[model samples]
Target chain A: MKKIIFGIAFIIFFSFLIVSAINMRTFGEPTYSEMDDYFIENAQSETGANNVVTSVVFDYRGFDTLGEATVLFTAVVGVVALFRGVKK
Target chain B: MIGNLPYVAVVIFVGLGIYTLMFKKNLIKIAIGVVLIENGVNLFLITLGYRKGAIAPIYTYAPSGQAMVLPTPQALTLTSIVIGIATTALILSVAMMIYKHYGTLDTDEVRRLKG
Candidate 1:
């Protein structure tokens, strides 16, 4: 009896969640009220890249990408150093 | 109309990859899931640079003033794919080390470094 009640409650909760998720806004639609014309105009010359996303990732935010790569490298190194050699 | 299929594919691949990462218990499976996610992201980047009717960014054979798919995303995707390969290799190597140490690939069983 208790299990049945719990199952029913779970179904109701999941139904609500599914409905809400269906109504949620997705990220694909562009929301910018005013598109940056400068980015579109000088993307090639300033960034020296034909893709805007690449310009955003490599040139505009190159330092951030560098830091991210460094962090991942450090994590790998740390993992390797920690688990160097031990017989199973 | 069909040009948007790649974008949908990216989303589906990313969603499945995340699901695998969250649900899989084996360290190797998790590593594979990460690779899948990286591939999905790269595919999305490529799709974003795609124009409905555009030639490759190369200027040699293309006519002047012709639309060209953006080259920057392709370059970035190349770099990202290389990074993803490196990461997958490193993770697999670590997983092998872990297996050697623990005799198991199940992440839950390898609890030597747990806090």
Candidate 2:
């Protein structure tokens, strides 16, 4: 039975592999990176952070981080609510 | 491409996750599958941000001529990882609750809500 699942997964992934191998961008060289170039060059000057990634996370796209925090908070709230009667 | 071995790893991870999801009977196993998929996607994002012979996005004494990897995807993946942890924890706790309420961890056994 496990073999069946494995076989199906193998075929699906193999198809995906073929599609990606044919249509994929060149390895290690990302196109459509004009935004990346701008951030790399200006992030230091704008955010005073040596790490561009950090600056982008905490500064440039702060609202997205806030949303993620909200999502985590909601999940924690739900989990706590569901398991509140565990000790009782 | 040979240089993109990380993608192969991503493919394996995703495939394993899907296989587990389809075949596993345990709720915890399903949660594990979800985590595996999340990790595979995160790896794919990091891979996309990667560039050959490039340094990380941090600069201290590094010269200007050196190529720097893309930071946006890395940042997005960071949040995703945190979110994944939260979601996994929630799923496991919910599964535990279902087990407590139903007196069994098996999904088919927990079908009735009156239990």
Candidate 3:
């Protein structure tokens, strides 16, 4: 009985997620294509990188990548610390 | 054509990874699932930059005026792969520690670290 209720709740929750994902739209004018085109055109000369995505990930949004790495590092460190000094 | 097969492979691998993560009770199995997912994502990123008839992104062999597979995704994939390796290694080490401390690999039973 409890398992049936949990399964029904899980199905409903995922159905809601599916609907929201399908319905989600860009908040503003779609600039990614235009920006991507601009980046592609000038990426080789400007960034010395042939891959536009690489330029975007490493150059245009490097700070964001750095922050992401930092967050992951901190999480790993925290997890390690939490489990430290335990008797084997 | 044939090049797109890698994309499908990535999807399948990722799906399998998620399934393993969701259903497996062993912490080591979950870590392996995470590695599988990382490899799938890396494969997807590499496939995104693939061109039908392009050579590797080596500058010395780059054709004069022909289309080439994008190199950025390769670089990004390299970074991600390294990070994935680091994560898997760390997770495996943690799992080892957990096993040493708890004498079992079942995630449900290893609840001491939880709040």
Candidate 4:
């Protein structure tokens, strides 16, 4: 019974995925890339970073990275709190 | 459409993650499955940014007149990877706590843990 349910769900899920893949646009030929162009042209001059991805992460999107760091800090605190009471 | 076929990998990863989450009884294994799904998503995003005849998004090596791979997805993937690490660490630590309290790592057994 478990196998039967799993098999059915898998088929349904895969079929959906395959259908979407077929409908999606071709690879390597994105329809929208204006932002990428803007970033590439300006990243070096604006941020003085040779690596566009790095500039985007550390300069353009620095706030997002800060939030991510905060999340990691919170998770570390939570984990420590969870296990703090127990020790050998 | 045909070029997008690489996404079959993303499909497989997601399927494997779901299978593990549904069938695996070990809490650590379920955490692994969650990580797998996160990786698959990151792969899909990176794949979407692919461009033909493009160089890496670095100004130093890019040819005088050429396209570069999208930087945003790569940045997003990096962020996601960092986030994935923190989440996995948190989940595993919780699993450790559960094991410490219940003396078992099996989800079913852990659920039977009493106060």
Candidate 5:
């Protein structure tokens, strides 16, 4: 009974997802890209970085990257702690 | 239909992930499901930032008149990939601990042995 209910719900959810994906805007054309335009235009001048994507990741959004690094460090610590004393 | 292929691929990825999460009983399989969902999300972000006839977003001798794909989504996807690696590592480690304690990876058996 539980499995049947779950199956029905899953099917319904996936149908919705498929419908939306098929209806999405054209693949190569994004609707609103002003922010990206600005970044591409001025990232090299402002950050002196040849790669705009690199500048955006490391300089423009430095704090977000820092937070991501912290999360990765924490996960590493957690995994190490969990495995402690298991090799013996 | 051809143009919307990437989005459909993303949906397929996420749908398979969800199915694995809901139907699989093994902890390792569930961890794989989580990773699948993460990859699907990263792909979606990348697909959202495309521009027709665009080249890489680099300023060092780039083509004279070509556009560049969005940089923000690429940056966010890099962060997400790092985060996904962290999450997958943690999940596998926890699954290992559970196997060590309960001597089984089956969710039903693990639940029954809870004490």
Candidate 6:
């Protein structure tokens, strides 16, 4: 009984997802890209980096990278703590 | 319909991940589902910024008269991949600890053994 209900729900949800995917905007043409355009135009002048993507990662959005680093550090600490009691 | 194939692929990725998360019994499978969803999201991000006939967003001494793809989404995807790695490591370690404690990886048995 529960399996049947779950299956029905899953099917319904998946159908919705499929419909949205099929109806999405055409590929290879983005609708709103002003920010990305700005980044591309000014990144060279501001950051002097040949790679705009790298500049965006390291300079434009460095804080996000910092947060990712912190999360990785925390995960490492947690894994070490969890396995501390085991020997060998 | 065919134009949106990449979006459909992304949705399929997420759907399979959700199914695995819901129906799988093993803790490891659940972790795999989580990883799949993260990968699906990463793929979606990359797909969003793709431009037809555009080059990479690099200002090197080449390809002077061509457009470039979006750089923000690529940058965001990098952050997301790093975060996914952290999340996967933590989830697997927790699953390992659970197995050590309960001697089983089945979710049903783990639930029953909860004290």
Tens digits of per-residue lDDT for model 1, B1-115: 2334555566667766765776678999999899998998898777656654666665345566755565556757766776787688788888887787789998678887777
How many clashes does the backbone of model 1 have?
A: 0
Per-residue lDDT over B80-113 for candidate 5, one digit per residue giving the tens place of the 0 to 100 score: 9999999999999898888888999998887864
Candidate with best lDDT = 5
Residues B1-115 of candidate 6 have per-residue lDDT tens digits of 7899999899899999999998999999999999999999899999999998999998887588998999999999998998999999999999998988899999888896456
- By descending DockQ, how would the candidates be arranged? 5, 6, 4, 2, 3, 1
lDDT by candidate, in order shown: 0.66, 0.85, 0.67, 0.87, 0.93, 0.91
Candidate 1 lDDT over residue span A1-88, tens digit each: 8557756765565455444434433323323312233444466688676665567567765775786677578767866676677457
Candidate 6, number of clashes: 0
How far is B86's C-alpha from truth in model 1 (Å)? 1.9
What CAPRI grade goes to candidate 4? medium
Docking class of 1: incorrect
Candidate 5 segments whose C-alpha is farther than 4 A from its true place:
A86-88, B112-115
For model 1 chain B, the run of ten residues with the poorest summed lDDT: B1-10
Write the number of the candidate with greater DockQ, choosing between 3 and 5.
5
**Alpha-carbon interface RMSD for all candidates, in angstroms:** 6.9, 2.2, 8.2, 1.5, 0.9, 1.0
Q: Which ten-residue region of model 3 chain B has the weakest summed lDDT?
A: B1-10
Which predicted model would earn the best DockQ? 5
Q: 2 or 4: which has the higher DockQ?
A: 4
Q: Which structure is stronger by lDDT: 1 or 3?
A: 3
Residue pairs in clash, model 6: none
Segments in model 2 whose C-alpha atoms lie over 4 Å from true places:
A1-10, A85-88, B61-64, B113-115
True-structure lDDT of candidate 4: 0.87
Tens-place lDDT digits, model 3, residues A37-59: 45556777888976556676788
Which of the predicted structures, 1 or 4, would earn the higher DockQ when compared with the native? 4
Q: What's model 2's TM-score?
A: 0.87
Fnat for each predicted structure, in order: 0.03, 0.63, 0.03, 0.79, 0.93, 0.86
Model 5, A33-78: lDDT tens digits are: 8889999999988999999999999999999899999999999899
Candidate 4: where is the Cα deviation over 4 Å?
Answer: A1-3, A85-88, B113-115
Clashing pairs in 3: none
Two-way TM-score contest, 2 vs 4, winner: 4
Task: State which candidate, 3 or 4, has the greater TM-score.
Answer: 4
lDDT per residue, candidate 2, B2-111, as tens digits?
66667877877887787778767788889999999899989989989998899999998776688999999999999999899999989998888788778787765767
